[model samples]
Target: MLLRIDHVGIACENLEEKIAFYRAAFGVTVVSQEVNEEQGVKEAMLHVADGEGGGSYIQLLEPTGPDTPVGKFLAKRGEGLHHVAYGVTDVTKAMAAMGGAGVRLVDEHPRHGAMGTSIAFLHPKDVGGVLTELVESPAPRPEQTKLKNG
Candidate 1:
């Protein structure tokens, strides 16, 4: 089951510049940042609000190379909204259900994503012309849970 709008992804040529822009423009700060080699991008997740057990993020993606997916997207569409990610209870189950319903999948199997989440992408054509990602975040560690609860 889909739980929430995890994040909205924006494609850009320069990650640092965009991050700075967001920080200056909206006063949001980066919560996490990493390079997912498999995804061929360097990405950062910026917090949208404060004081939360859970909250949505704005994911800024910068392609590592010209041949990467985000790179191609930039070449074609320029820097802008790329995809919307939905947090799911189980990405494997979600993929199965979407596939059973005849939705085209970009990933046949879940792959590692930023912050250790299991993720899979659904085809844009099958999802109302918007690229969709299903994300199953790793269970929070006990210390993290306590921090959130306290």
Candidate 2:
């Protein structure tokens, strides 16, 4: 089951530059950062709202190579909004449900994502021309539960 909007992916030519812009203009802080070799991207997650787990984020993505998907995207579309990711309880089930419903998928199986989450992507053509991602993060800690309620 999908829980909520997880994050918005923004393709950028440089991660540090984009990160600096967000920090200077919006005071957004990078909560986590990592490079996903499989995804061929260097990503930085900036948490918004209350800084609680499962909250929305801005995921800055820098292409690792010109041949990668994000790289090709940048070459064709330039740097801009790339995808919108939704938080799900079970990526496998969610992906299956979408497939059963005839929704086209970019990733047919859940794969490793930034921040140790399970993730899959739905093809843009099937999702109203927006590349959509399904993310399933580990259960939040007790403190996060309190933050969510508070």
Candidate 3:
């Protein structure tokens, strides 16, 4: 059901500080950063090198407003791993199976994810006290594919 480990979501209060830290610590480059209003968060993605083997990415998630999900998470957990995202080939199918078996979801349908993917969240109450994310890719972007083909 799961294809690979997608990006891990980390909760951060100041994205610039975190970005600088990550850049200096791991030498990663920021690929994109955007605010997703529907999901209610601002996110920054730091790309990892392909030849360095395959850990996905560094996703810096900041709350959009004082009442957002990420905001609540920060209030509760402080700065830490917010969620573990698992890549699935088919999010709809995967979510259906999980739902049929009584898993609680944060969303019924997948929403826009960073890096051109679809995403859904599983409630922490149903996942052994840890929040989880299910992500489905919409095929790699053309330039990304070219990087692979090269």
TM-score leader: 1
Residue pairs with clashing backbones, model 2: none
Q: Against the true structure, what is each candidate's TM-score?
A: 0.91, 0.90, 0.89
Tell me the RMSD of model 3 versus the true structure.
2.4
What is candidate 1's lDDT per residue for 1-150, written digit by digit as tens?
Answer: 768788899999999999999999999978889998988999999877432334568999999999999999999999999999988888999999999999999998899987778999999999899999998878863345666789
Expressed as tens digits, the lDDT of each residue in 1-150 for candidate 2 is 667888999999999999999999999889889998998999999877544337678999999999999999999999999999998888989998999988888886789887778899998888889999999987773345778678
Worst 10 residues of 2 by lDDT: 47-56
Question: Given candidate 3, what's the lDDT at residue 119?
Answer: 86
lDDT of 1: 0.88
* Candidate 3 deviant stretches above 4 angstroms: 49-55
Instruction: Supply the global lDDT for candidate 3.
Output: 0.83
| Number of residue pairs clashing in candidate 2, backbone atoms closer than 3 angstroms, sequence gap of 3 or more or interchain | 0
Off by over 4 Å in 1: 49-53, 141-147
Question: What total of clashing residue pairs does each candidate reach?
Answer: 0, 0, 0
TM-score for predicted model 2 compared with the true structure: 0.90
Candidate 1, which ten residues in sequence have the lowest lDDT sum?
47-56
